[model samples]
Target: MLISTSKSLFSSLIISTRNTSNLFIGKNVRLRNYHNKFPLAGIKVTVLKEPFNSQLIPKLFENFGAEITIFCDTSNIKKQSIDLNLTNSDFVKAEVFGTKVTPKKYIEAGEREIDLSVDGDLNVLKKYAIKSDIFINLENKRFGEIGFNPEEIIKLNPKLIFANISNFNQTNSKFVFVKENMNEEYLELLHQNSKTLFTLGEISCFTKILLTLFNKQNSGKGQILNLSISDSLLHLNRLTSPLLLSIPNAFDRFYLTKDKKVFSLCLPTINDQQKFLKNLNLTNSKEMSAKIAEFDLSELNMFLKGSLCVCIC
Candidate 1:
């Protein structure tokens, strides 16, 4: 997710820019939270393309809101199109990896997928993006020039990458990208917030742009490698304006102890949480949970819910 401060518009824009919105798969915590926050309230939401999340929209009024409205993606208004922002566009050849490598093959060597499409080509994608007060980019596919013109795509990435961040970076906003894979607690927070927001795929060069956009001066400017909260912030001078602190999380951790679904789709319990913890040597390092302290992996939810907001540096 991107958190950008627009000095011109004068607003703190925090947004999620990924397709995880589909993860709701008939359930939306945002809607759930909205109901809890303001019962029978009418809030405006704009979704692009897929009508998956509409599951929650149909029955919203039964519980709250004087009127349920759709301002974008009106195709599913009957189901739950609160806001509509449809646009005209043409289909572009899907760039699976910004390279010649397909996702499945890339992962065989332990990699991630990223693809891209151009504005006129990705017209549908671009159209949906600009419509939002805060555009969200669901890394549907990262397109890049794998062979001859990679920069063609790389250049496209920083610009086409939609989010409140782009709005700010387009204007040059100060921000931070924290890195510390050893961290699981705050890491989850970053993941939870940004999983649907910012995407770097697997390539670090593209990632550099992703990072620099927070605030950069070309030539690897505003980019920090091997992210660590303390070290990254240390390099950043005090900012006169609000800063967008972004942490990358989605899947670097494999431990699953607290997750209600320890085994998705009947998959065997892959890693023993306790053994995983013990292996981490966190007991000797800074930690919070005794479960984690004891060196045992646990449910993702358990590890998360028992998560300590304060880190045990």
Candidate 2:
């Protein structure tokens, strides 16, 4: 099966177990990760470079033993932040074979700014999209009659794992939304603190795709995972939002110590506040920052025992 995380390297050991010998079709070595626990091991994986997010796939799936082939214009490879010679070494740490495609895409756009929305020919890119089991579409443009079409690519490769990453939200049947898992009152409080009353989009979408990949690998099904940037951030709000709402005035309750360390004190009730003072010799909210900064995490944990206060810094 497809074990997505670094923690579970052998839940279904796709690389060493699966019979995917026919999938290794190319020979040009481009990007490589050499981790002992390769998740996408034995599968010939192709990454489309251009979209900013496509650049992240190799690192994300590095330990999963997939022979990763980056399909991009050769110049794009040079544009990466890391030195060219060190690229192979980085992949080796992740435990996978990495390579790139030849007869590159953008030629005239060299050193000149090229908009991914209109840079390469859609027809040619489509062929590369379904070339492997998993296709990472970071094409920073909309998909349609004139753009990168998702539906069309699936038709070309029915078993392809297609992931479209862009700035905003996109919809598809395979995409799943994570539950916020918070009380109604807590959500309302968090909504007031945020601009659009939504979670950070990038974090949420990333988590959703990870969960989807895990499920798909276990089932051997091609899936489409869609996540909105805003909604995803909201999912994470469940951790800190409730604590902030428990206090009298959350925004004001946040304090900065003399040493420039920031922390929050959320006391749900007067008894809890009294207990906090009795247990830690902390009288007023003003003394909290300095007192907390003086103590280590273990000391703080002890003070928080049998207490309703949420100490977050």
Candidate 3:
């Protein structure tokens, strides 16, 4: 599950009781919460790395038949345009904030027009308002320690670092996924043998093969796969592989992971696995056409990739 806001985590917990409610924590997509009270099914949501052209609430409610609330870290000052846009839908507002002294007292502040929060990522929740049932979170990195800039990366981590999230309780997003419940395999073998690595490819085959390896191994016991998986199908190959970015003049961070053995996921088009894995990392050098068609290509999109894809430089 890809719970976007740290603030909306609890109410998500209160609404239902299903193991599918596990939040997307970093690249691992590991399941940390086993005691959820929410019925975790039939809820699949994805957005926020990019914005939709229309209001998502009415559409989600129309499509999903539930209150499609949007919880965002408040990112802008003229949040009213967002508010005006939301007025037509079933969208309401809420906030996700953290107090200075305690990680124990995470609170959700709700206001009809504008949800409130002290930690100040209210806009993070708002970003989902377009096609969601609810709206939550208000932000500015200055307001809280964490918020995103025009760039999609997390801006700051003063109050909550990546490590802090492991300790913090947040709601898991609605996902069609299974939990990587802690097992002796990952635990016993994790004594430094696991390594994290990333690759960027204009050549999709390398990335495709890598993701397949991770999924087959359940995200690998020790290695981490950081992929800059792009939706650009026309360019079927990563004109440049991940290592190309290290050249100093390059731009854009590639997908990344902290663990060495576990592979971070990267599959294209969230849906239609066949189309996503079409090329499956193959190519003819001269004509740039796929030459080696050996692997079984039917199971392309059957395996849904993780909610988390960490980019590294």
Candidate 4:
């Protein structure tokens, strides 16, 4: 199933299979090198969503050698293409030639846009589910609002790894939306908040999905993964800085260097602070800004290396 490395820091090996009945649990099998480079080769993935939403998921799967097929309606595809400035000729080429002749922009937007109407028959989705190893749903709609039944699809393909990304969890009816008729000021606020929420949500879902894939390798079973943007943001906030939860902007801040370059530094503990100050031959943190201003970004980077300071440029 799954083979992980020991704590010695050696390279780890992972082996996966659909049939575990013939697998030897603890016995060592002779290792052989194979020319195949892609870890997810032969894995079939089906994604149900517009091309604009959750583009990274399909790209990630494609990078790992998984065959990804995205199903969405024609209007959404046209809107996305228009928004991204993709020409009809290029879109047609991408559709006809697939990845072989796909432009970088088309790939970035999402590859091979299949037109499957959301109002279409459930049997169409079922056809894909029966052969797919992984199914990802990035539609903004609630589970009930989604045209097909997830349970029925899973029953058709027991080994399918189903993942759903929503604005909120299934139980919560509250949806994220701003009507076109809304005032500009109110719409702007909604847009900004939604952007931030979705960004954090995508990060959380990406991590959880990777972990779920690993779990499936170990257990040889499939499970449903439900991720909400708001919930993910809360979870991330808790894990990142629990003590500074009440204090706004308590985390690291960026500074402009003498050469106008930007960087962020963190000296969390007393020892780190002492080490940083000692390296700079300074007595207090009060001189940090002035001292940092004296050096160029490159010089500052070199100075922070062994001073127990975490610096990002």
Candidate 5:
């Protein structure tokens, strides 16, 4: 789930970003948070193409009345039109203000290759970006085409808050790349909580931008933030790792009462196991498990109710 911020912060913007793979699929990111805060009502923003995290940057800026200008290839525009179920013109109007000048026609004039990593590409984009307060680059696919160093682009306009989305943390030392990863090995811990994969990077990067946008820091200049999916999962797992290790053979058990399945790190003591066997009139571990499997749904529900299993650490 996408963590929420303040309501006053979201009201000014039309939230369009969402987490497509998690619970409540396709839910907008803005409907969740509300704390007393400032809004970006008048800031100007320019975004290049749409990436996985594309919905968030614009929504956050919109919360503060920020005027957004999105520049994407014609193919991307058509795809968005189909995805959002809106006409091309209608979609354009929904993203930008009426009075703001858009380079739609200018961009469509030629098949221009805009790569922010390249000095020439950066210069071309700068023409449209010079007038904006922030620049967000979501074109991770074209990141390899970056020719000039990121430091030079920051020198072009130090005041601007630039956010670039890339899986690798090598975009530039000046710009933070939130890394989102998807791996099969994490399935063990991931299945334990129905947790989605590689979403931590998106959440971390979004939080970083919010911190800077609220003037919580001196300036976003020269700051680089990396939020990788694996890194985020590691950070999250650290909280309960010690307690999990405290128990012997904690990873070996997968709780099963018939078809209903649950997991427990609770390793019953020898004394407790003996008592359970005697109470159930069972002689062996296999017999004990068979008795448990025969329990009715309601019986099982009451037996396992409450905090019978808690890690003190």
Candidate 6:
């Protein structure tokens, strides 16, 4: 009788696993179909040299269904355009930025080919600028220096949104000298990492541009937006309290298990911390670490299931 009951339970588990697998497969098929109708459909965006030559910003616009026209100098036009194509590699590498992104297979089939053009001649930019709803310039040069005037473009298209990406706020007098003389070494020292400051700044700038676009849709207005890498780094630094330095391990956000696998722990509020301590019957992170060390990663995951403590392993 005992053997029969165990066999019955094992069979049920196998059936449940198969059902879950099929459900996920069906969901993925639905997601692939959903990309046919994107939120930014019919939006015309003109991108002039991506920030730090990362190619990520334009890809974001493409992913959301915008018609993208990317203009680069004669030297980089071909290379940048080729990089936009979806490759069959296991990971997508942003070679210039020194980062590898996780493969998102869903976007591969739906991506439209980008329109590339040489940006040296003012006539070409003027032709597209007049028709573009959104204009992004990350070249770090004034419009006049680039061969055209922003006022002329605005006059032609009053509802055009312009996003300027730079290393420092151009209008601020204090950062004017630094912006002109800034080099790779100075940037690395400022953020204590190479290229991370630019990456963060670009993402923040992209988010702000999207918010501005949302506002423009309702208000029927266009505006100029500016983002600086230095300002983005400063904003992030301000979030860390100076008093945190006095506490031991106050900044530790990850813990190790018996199997040597690391996982993140997030207790954002006092209530969350209290709930985590009560659920684990522990008073501090040290105790939590000791407790976690007793189990392998798989066992720890099972142990913490349905608990208030937010953990990612």
Candidate with more favorable, higher TM-score: 1 or 2: 2
Off-target runs (Cα >4 Å) in candidate 6 are 1-37, 50-52, 75-120, 169-192, 240-313
Native-to-model Cα distance after best TM-score fit, residue 30 in candidate 1, in Å: 34
| Backbone clashes, candidate 1 | 41
Worst 10 residues of 4 by lDDT: 1-10
How displaced is residue 38 in candidate 5, in Å?
Answer: 5.9
Error of 2 at 87 (Å): 23
Q: What would the per-residue lDDT of candidate 4 be over residues 49-123, giving only the tens digit for each residue?
A: 643344655676676566788765333333332334545444444443343232235332444444445444345
Q: Compare candidates 4 and 6 on lDDT and give the better one.
A: 4
How far out, in Å, is residue 147 in model 1? Answer: 15
Candidate 6 lDDT, 1-313, residue by residue in tens: 4224323423322223324545544441211111223455566898776212446677877776778887653322224323344442322223222343322231223232222333535567777878888998756565556666777788878788988766665443212222432323223323222245445656667777877777775676788877675465444433544432232332223344565443434444455556555666777655666676566666645544564443211
In model 4, the clashing pairs are: none
| Backbone Cα, N, C clashes tallied per candidate | 41, 30, 79, 0, 16, 0
Q: Rate the local accuracy (lDDT) of all candidates.
A: 0.24, 0.45, 0.25, 0.53, 0.44, 0.52
List ranges where model 2 is wrong by over 4 Å.
1-10, 13-36, 44-57, 69-120, 169-207, 239-313
Off by over 4 Å in 5: 1-38, 50-54, 73-122, 141-144, 168-197, 214-230, 239-313
Query: Which 10 residues in a row give candidate 5 its minimum summed lDDT?
Result: 174-183
Q: Return whichever of 4 and 5 wins on TM-score.
A: 4
The candidates, ranked best first by lDDT, are 4, 6, 2, 5, 3, 1
RMSD of each candidate relative to the true structure: 18.6, 14.2, 20.5, 13.0, 16.5, 18.4
Which candidate number has the best lDDT? 4
Instruction: Point out the worst 10-residue segment of candidate 3 by lDDT.
Output: 160-169
Q: Candidate 5, residues 1-313: lDDT per residue as tens digits?
A: 2234534334444233343345453442223222234345455777666312235455656654567777653332222223345434443343321322222332432124453445666666766665555666555443235442444555765556666654454422211212222112222223243233234445566666666555522333433333333343334433545543343332213333453432232433554445445555677655444576575434544444442343211
Kindly list the per-residue Cα lDDT of model 2 for residues 95-155, writing each as its tens digit. 2224432112232221223333455644555666676666654433334523566776778
lDDT of 3 by residue, 135-229 (tens): 11212112134433322222221111110101011232111111221122222322221112111211232333223322333423222122221
Q: In terms of TM-score, which candidate is strongest? A: 4
Best-first order by TM-score: 4, 6, 2, 5, 1, 3
1-313 per-residue lDDT for model 1 (tens digits): 1212112111111123233465544441232222332332332222222211122222332233323222222121122232223211100011211211111111112112222222332454343333321122211211221121223322433332222111111112122122111111222333332322222211222223234333421232221122222222222312211221221111122222232111111111223333334444444312423333233233333443432221111
